[model samples]
Target chain A: MSEPFRFHTRLNLVELLGRRAGTVRELLTGIREVPGASIYHHTHRFLQQHHFLSPEPPNDFAYWISGSLGLNDIGERLASIDTVRYRRINDLRTRYVEILEEALAARRNSWPVCQESDEFHFMSCRTFIIPLPAVARDAGEFLDILGRISVNSLYYHVFESRLWLERGENDFAVWFEARGDHELAGALARLDPYTITLEGLRQEIIGLVRRHVQDR
Target chain B: MSRIDDYVPVAGASEVEELRLLAARLEGKTIRNVNSTAVGGGVAEILTRMLPLLKELGVDARWDVIKGNERFFAVTKNMHNALHGMDVPVTGDDLDFFVDVNRRNAAEMDLASDILFIHDPQPIALVERKGDLGGKWIWRCHIDFTDPRPEIWAFLKGYIERYDGAVFSAPAFSRPLSVRQVLISPSIDPLSDKNRDLGEDEIDRVCAGYGIDRGRPIVTQISRFDYLKDPVGVIKAYRMVKEHMDCQLVLAGGGATDDPEGLRVLDEVKREAEGDPDVLVLFLPPASDIEINALQRASSVVLQKSLKEGFGLTVAEALWKAKPVIASAVGGIPLQIAHKYSGILTRTVEGAAFWIKQLLQEPEYARKLGVNGREHIRANYLITRHIRDYLLLFLSLYFEKDVIRL
Candidate 1:
């Protein structure tokens, strides 16, 4: 008999949050300590203010685990993870490191630093920072993270898979490889950092306004 | 009766009017004109300006373009190259395609006029439809057909025999065809944007925009981006002249939509002029008439170094501006420019460079040549004279005259 086809679900927010729990915890705490800290404080306040202890049933395994541990308690659980699972994660990380090394080597040898301003800068490290208002901090962080992670990872995954053997795939491969260059990726990485700081500052102002509202 | 004032004449307006009056004697006759294109070429440009003038003279003059799709055009383009003495393959399929397109155009077009004029090879097959609509058909060839490919000529001769007469631009371009052939050179409209006088400010502005120094000696040629124009040869001549005389060359022209080989030829030209700072290779758009006029006016000497020319209008345009021209003594150029009198004629790059250096050295001689050239154009190659010739030719079909006394 023919083997049955296996359909795998894509990795979601639950998997990503669980995998990088320590980093997320450290980022969240650093944001909350600063009042009037721009977008950073607002981002932490939004994460901490969510009703994790609500009586509603958790949607999935990652949500249930997250709720049990609480948002502030993720760093300790990540540290206490079993050795076998940690080893597997390390192996995946090493594979990613090798792919990046190969790309860097290719870039160093072949690519020229694009000098013509008239032509589109396809592989440049230029970043544009947009100032976000204090009130729309959580919404801003959500959008900023969504834009950077989804687009950049999608670009990197396409190049790493080498899906360029098909007839029409060359154009797509060129576009993704251009976007996933080190300079372009570095520019995109700074977007999340600036977004997080702006979000934090927005929340502190909102809290002060709320206290004024209650007293009145 | 239609008056001559209704028509816009470029030159020799009075003589044209006199001829039109003579043509009015034969009032009821119909006159027809056949040519390759109704746009982009000199034949089309002349016919567009001349047809109305003829109609206003009480002679019925109509113009027609030969119909051809991309494949037919490609074959005809090869035929064009072959007729210029290039050894190109004119396959049976190419002839078949040419005949098929002509037959199709003949079916759709009305060929019932009294005097039918067939322009070039593209519409030469329309003479096959002459049995049903009998008239005096004239084959007006605007190209050098002295050494056409034998196979292609044999095929075209079957249609050429049907014509009552043939017209050639130059005596050299003529071959011993069965029909009676006449020589009538092409002319230019002095009032047209490419030849008309521009204000000093407008000329200055255009020169500034293109980074052309108005004070420096500018040598220019304005023709379509075709191999026959020999833009690369113009650069060679310019470089040779630059050895002694400090001058800049402007190779300014546009490509027509009908010519498929234009882009490839332009790319080859750009490759040849890789690092030449003094050479300005401008690929002007079709609508750049004023800019062309400005360049010609600003030029110290105008050159048309065509390897093979049907009729280089740039010679007439420069002459109309009273600028001394150094043109190749090929095709219709000799008809316009009389060597050392009206303009200097040359055959090779060395000859052209020699004349350019001479003209730069002696301003008085160059100025006198320019003066003689303007009067020559005024006497022979103006649109007025061209319109008068057609009017007279149309009238002659009905009435036989020993000499046309316009």
Candidate 2:
């Protein structure tokens, strides 16, 4: 099996972080300094920089944010931020933790997230979930990307891969592009062997995710 | 009546009028349909098309979608598989979750339709709310219920008895229900965008757009990304035929809104067809009706090799276009294909492959089969027939007499 395609041209995490430091600093400062702007904007912009958010407006920010940051905090934060109501930051912190826990709960039981069968032409019923390793290693990035893609799209791509790994070829680029994470796509190409079988890649992904999760 | 005539050419204007008259007899009566989702699966597709027609017929038809989070849907999805004879372990929590969601939906929805039609097992428990609703409720089982998980079936039987009657697509799907059972097979709307006749140029343009070769014989199967559709089996059959004949296989389909198993099935299919140059697997959207119609019409032979099927509408759609289809002898497919007379029926990959090779080799036989298949569909499976049957069914519930000659 050929190495999976890598989305990033360079694998240096430090270099990538350095290049993205300005945006990350802007995001952090925006949340801390801006009186009216909430962390939602900062998180969204950070996600967008990582190719998780689309260039289009209303890119599933609510669900991802709500999923990542408990629903109550999101509602309160959005309300306070937009309405300029002075709310304690501690409340926001508590809500964020609650949301993360909920998301984690969803992640735990939502294992093997199946896609709708009517979306594509494939044979076996399949599903996908973010490997614990992948999630732990890049929780923020994962959440950012998760926020951008519709629930249906996420399910569809994952399910498609489960049914026919070759279908992976169809969406590997698009899935990353949608998340604004071309680096991952590049990483896949580099890791994937040209003549590799679908099962081999799936196993590799599963193993990587398991190891990543274990490391965390 | 005029509406039917405008949309369906097979139904005589008078026949359609009779249907309208029957429908008018039931006017002002509330008819509710309970199902899993409002989009994706065939039940949703059929309802989306049928509900408006029922409304046009002066019946107060409404659709209700059951609510479920991912865990709930996952359980129901497993129940669906279990009902189809798959050995899925339905945990006690799964059952509890199923009832919990159904109970919630039952409480939320106004279950007051004069004729309450419950589709499949997903919302079967909604029938539990039948107490003093002062109306007849019908359980419409769309999937193959001939062999179901005994526990699931037994649990569902309690709810089934609450309904006034039950509807099944095939006799095989019917079980020993306490309530009366009505066998009403599914139908295809020949007049719909997905089944309408396209101009030769339009067909050519669609074929060109899909990069499907016009010079060779085309075998197509358009279905959802589900294992029951047996897309991988279709590829294997196509490969077998390719050994002797020069043809192309186009597996074109899309996902539905409610199904959570589509993407995985699609991926598995793609892996199985690796390095196959002649096979074209298309992940089309639900709205690609015209494309589907064009693919069916362009093809010399169509295949629907389903391991199990509620009703393979693609088979009817192909036959409506007078294309010979070879389908698995499962679910509602046998209702459409009458063996060697209308279309070929196969049980295994070898059987399917044999028929595909035979059809490709014998043009005359294939042509006759296509002709017979088209007439069979025209006679029984068209939307006109479907509308008429439904109208009659609605009237029969009131009349109770079988000898109502049209």
lDDT (tens digit, per residue) of candidate 1 on A42-158? 112222211111121111111212322333233233222221121132332333234333433442333222211111100101111111121212223323332322121222222
Q: What is the lDDT of residue B298 in candidate 1?
A: 89
Instruction: Name the best candidate (by TM-score).
Output: 2
Q: Write down the worst ten-residue block by lDDT for model 2 chain A.
A: A9-18
Q: Model-by-model lDDT, in order?
A: 0.58, 0.62
For every model shown, what is its TM-score relative to the native structure? 0.60, 0.61
Query: Model 2, stretches more than 4 Å misplaced?
Result: A1-216, B1-3, B256-276, B399-401, B404-406
- DockQ scores for all predicted structures: 0.00, 0.01
Error of 2 at B76 (Å): 2.2
Least well predicted 10-residue stretch by lDDT in candidate 1 chain A:
A9-18
Q: For each model in turn, which proportion of the native inter-chain contacts is also found?
A: 0.00, 0.00
Q: Across residues B273-308, which tens digit of lDDT does each residue of candidate 2 receive?
A: 778777888999758989988999999889999887
